[model samples]
Target: MSNRDYSLSDVVALLVESGDNASTFYRYSDDVPMPSVEVLSEIVEDLRTVLFPGYYGPSEITPDTMPYYIGSTLDRVERHLADQINRGYCFVCDKNKVDRCQDCETRSRNMARAFITKLPEIRELLLSDVEAAYDGDPAAKTHGETIFCYPSIRTMTNHRIAHELYKLGVDIIPRIIGEMAHSDTGIDIHPGATIGRSFFMDHGTGTVIGETCVIGDNVRVYQGVTLGAKSFPKGDDERLIKGLPRHPLVEDDVIIYAGATILGRVTIGKGAVIGGNVWITRDVPAGAQIVQSRAMQQSFSDGGGI
Candidate 1:
């Protein structure tokens, strides 16, 4: 071993040199104000309080004070969310060329207000999801329990909020919100996935729903299920094409069991039951049951079959 002395100053200098490299994906200067995860987390908490009322925020909230509490929380959420949205816009803006004169603050405020207006609808969808969870899971005692305790509810709540922001064309912030949920729960759902009402994920861990997936109403899925792409298409320039519908299309009343991997742009028809540990890449007809074939028992001298 060669003896070498390395000071903290030397390490700092090396890091500075690496950061100054133009080939690296580094954000500086105009990207001074990036979307903050801390602020975004606080915004999520405030929004959750607005959505679930007494379940998330203060426990002493009476019906009389509920309206006031919700209003105040919404006001805070709007202000903070608008700021984060503006940062997201600024992060992507070509300040030297296209968006130098863009009114990002105004646009962000308008987007935040638009998201606030849709809270009632988002709550309606969440109510449906809560009910679906209660009805689907025999262990669930009440819909309130699902709202208060279930990771699915929390994850879905974040997804619903993120989905709205994605629809409103706000970038970065939605993904941060989605990732917050994913960090808490093992479920990873892309913000771009379009999901209808009454969706329930039983046990919920390790479930991955990809971008461009369109899931219909009253759909239920178990843990370890993957709704992913089969393959990625590339352009003539050798860069992988994006924004294409590569994920599965799950229809109404479909039930996907645990450990099932449904890949590609395949359509899962209405009322279909996908069995556990099954791998599917093609479209299924309505009212079909897809399951793994029976395992054959064979005698082996070396006990390999066991």
Candidate 2:
């Protein structure tokens, strides 16, 4: 029945109507190009190679050949990162209805160069993370095994890179980078989260660290743990507010076990230990140990009476 009635002209008309309906979600700016996820994926890998040169890159890396490899890798990173960062800048400008695209090229190049310069710092922090993972897990044989085989290593590496871009005020790309790691590792860490040194995630799958979370040094968390906001505040227009500090602030040396969910902007003081499967919404003092209390049981009569 459809074959007898529909023609190519009718199909073209329907396609036009569909496109019209999709206009609200489409970006129409010709000057602004969306950041490429594929390109960003490659950028993350390249940066990883730089951070752990011999481990991630070619196996032939030696002390004598390190300089040439590093120099060439850095050059490639600069070129690709500048292009992607420029796209990110333009995309944000278009979304915010700002007319700063003219200067974005210069800004992107400068930001990329600045980011490259921070590689040493990033590498230092990542080493701390790797150390934390190795020390926290007794099963880990060596730092190299943890670096190559652990999901936390992959997730944190991506997070550290994305966090740097976020700090530099780059938009969209950070979130994209975060999502890439999330997809690959099953660990979700927001780019805006302020994580400190020696952060460790053991069995990191299903861990969620929300945006605005401030984690201090030597903090460790386990699988299925969530440091998240309890609720969202709505404005007069009923729109959810943005940019508020909503996630928890975890202090140094805190250990949150598996399935522990800490909500809102509560603080977990230094040296505190949160036990598995506990739900916390309030601040816990220093050196405190939080665990779920035992459930009370009631005796019942035989059959149906209580």
Q: List TM-scores for all candidates, in order.
A: 0.92, 0.91
Q: Candidate 1, residues 1-306: lDDT per residue as tens digits? A: 222666777778777887786634466654548789999999999888888988898989999999999988899899999999988877766433344435778999999999999999999999999999999999999888999999999999999999999999997888999999999999999999999999999999999999899999999999999999999999999999999999999999999999999999988889989889988787877877777654421221122211
Clashing residue pairs, backbone N/CA/C < 3 A, model 1: none
| Candidate 2: tens digits of C-alpha lDDT, residues 116-220 | 998999999999999999999999999999899999999999999999999998878999999999999999999999999999999989999999999999999
Clashes of 2: 0
- Candidate 2 collision pairs: none
Worst 10 residues of 2 by lDDT: 296-305
Provide the clashing-pair count of each candidate structure.
0, 0
Q: Go through the candidates in order and give each one's C-alpha lDDT.
A: 0.88, 0.89
Model 2 residue runs over 4 Å out of place are 1-24, 295-306
Give the RMSD in angstroms, all C-alphas superposed, for model 1: 5.3
> Any idea what lDDT model 1 has?
0.88
